[model samples]
Target: MLDQISRGAVGVLVVEDDAVTRKTLCLAIESAPELKLLTAFDSVKPALAWLETTRPDVLLTDLGLPDGSGIEIIHACTHRYPQTDIMVVTMSSDEANVLACIEAGASGYVLKDAGKMDIARAVLDLRAGGAPMSPTIARMVLAKVRDGKKPQAATFPTAGDTTSLTKREAAILDLIAQGDSYGEVAKLLSVSVGTVQTHIKNIYGKLAVHSRGEAVFEAHRRGLLKLGHPRSE
Candidate 1:
């Protein structure tokens, strides 16, 4: 399964100005079963140069680099390798950083303060097309939306295609749209409780909605799923 992933065999890139962090990030990525360490760079100059050539599956970048900001890397990634997922693993949990990264097409924003396992899970989630954001960062981003501010224009791909979901995720949504609980969906999908949570995360992003009900409504609006489909008990 890992080998079948695009550029998955080679693994992700780590870009941070801090030497210790660069090494730690590489080691952490290597620790994951599916993630192979590619190259660890300390600045945008080299990171961009390498990305122009060998596009990795995921990128762990810090917001502040000696040569440029991590946002520069995000722009470069989207412009060059749109398929590659960018995760900002940094110390800044500020709302501005959270909003800037997402607006620039960042796939996820994880705080360095999160657990090490959270970092590994985040990378895996990114590789599997999931948006893994830190709760703190998630709150910051949501706070802005709750305040009713329009998001700045960003260049995210139009997910009009139906391939945005896996078979299991789609199945789970079919149940969710009909009012299934996380535990019930997990049982139906034959996956663990945590797996169900991850599927819901992907569902929310794909549908551009925050909750199960919103996703169901959005999916109907997009004509991807029928509004009143019967769900099994």
Candidate 2:
């Protein structure tokens, strides 16, 4: 464990039941100069206890644990410290499990097989306000929404729930649903990045979501997104 805490590095808390995997994740965080490994745990109990005392800037947790599910930890983190970004690293690619974690407030989802470097970069990206998901995970999430699997009632709006978005907000959401980043949306809309962010904040409020994935999923569920057609005005 490289325990040298960088002065301004992003603090990361890791939770993985597998010993080897836990070490790998810890190493990945330590390898990046921009990230600091606050601590790593093998199960949910210790991780939850640690979270009670300290809040890390980023959370990397595995879904399955011997003591309890990682979703519990995610819930606690989101509820207590909504600013802390969370990522999931697990072997399971099941859509339902993935959705459950996202609903629990995870913004990033990556399989355990992803390279250590990729995982490290993902943490940085999450800290930088990007939703970093594995390619397969991203595809699966989109496919689920496309196949009309209605999202469950949680923090986000449910099916047939009318979320009134302004024309500008709807336009921005459509562009984002088509995979545009904040910068890209700003450029296309001839606005500042801050403006795009403000609209997204309002969109999140309207959709009752805290993350980009949740907002997009809720928007799609309510038929507010026009995927391929971005605003021409």
Candidate 3:
């Protein structure tokens, strides 16, 4: 895995259909000194073609492409180039599409309305092992967990093993499922934000999940935490 910060300039590939939106994203990426604009495409077909020979550090793509759904490209990059951080940059804030992209291996999701700078920062954040999500999208994910939607079965180690979460980690997961942000969780737990991030990283590893939504879902599925119940402080 590439250490995002250690790398001088990360290569970025963008796939969007709208001319204006695509241009806006390209310029935003160009403005970041740590990011390199590898290429931009208007459709999934050409994006897939480019992926066949080249691998980028980050992928910013729209979910609704003229040729086909950008989910295809997301899946392609994720499976083919496991190291690439894939993010969905689109207007779709609907739960279904958001969940679909998450399950398809997108590490981040950003709405086009987030403006160019937010989009650019999302890529950088993703490279830094952060799951950048629009506020609305983050709320949708928390709601999904609260609704008790069945999550995919755990593919990682089961509870009671060495890989199982420590009690503190489980508590952190409960807070996160309750829709607490990282900073909030840190304050509530009386720890630093960096400590919360470390626990979350371990939680993601044990849950075999890529995003916060998936982690919560998998935690629920594995009986790690009860849905709609936040742990008492």
Per-model TM against the reference: 0.62, 0.84, 0.71
Q: How accurate locally, in lDDT, is each candidate? A: 0.69, 0.82, 0.78
> Mind sharing the TM-score for model 3?
0.71
Task: Residues 1-233, candidate 3: write the lDDT tens digits.
Answer: 23563477889999989999889889988887788888999998999999999999999999988889999998888768866888888898888899899877786788877654466677776776567888888777767665654443344435664446677888888876665667777888899989988888788788766656567667766667765566654
Q: Per-residue lDDT of 61-97 in model 1, one digit per residue for the tens?
A: 9998888799898878766775567788888887777
Number of the top-ranking candidate, with lDDT as the measure:
2
Winner by lDDT between candidate 3 and candidate 1: 3
Worst 10 residues of 3 by lDDT: 149-158
How far residue 226's Cα lies from its native spot in candidate 1, in Å, is 17
Q: Weakest 10 consecutive residues, lDDT, candidate 1?
A: 148-157
Which residue runs does candidate 1 get wrong by more than 4 Å? Answer: 1-10, 115-117, 149-233
**Local distance difference test, candidate 1:** 0.69
* Cα lDDT of model 2 by residue, 140-223, tens digit: 877877776344334356467666888889888877765567787898899998999899889988988876777777777676
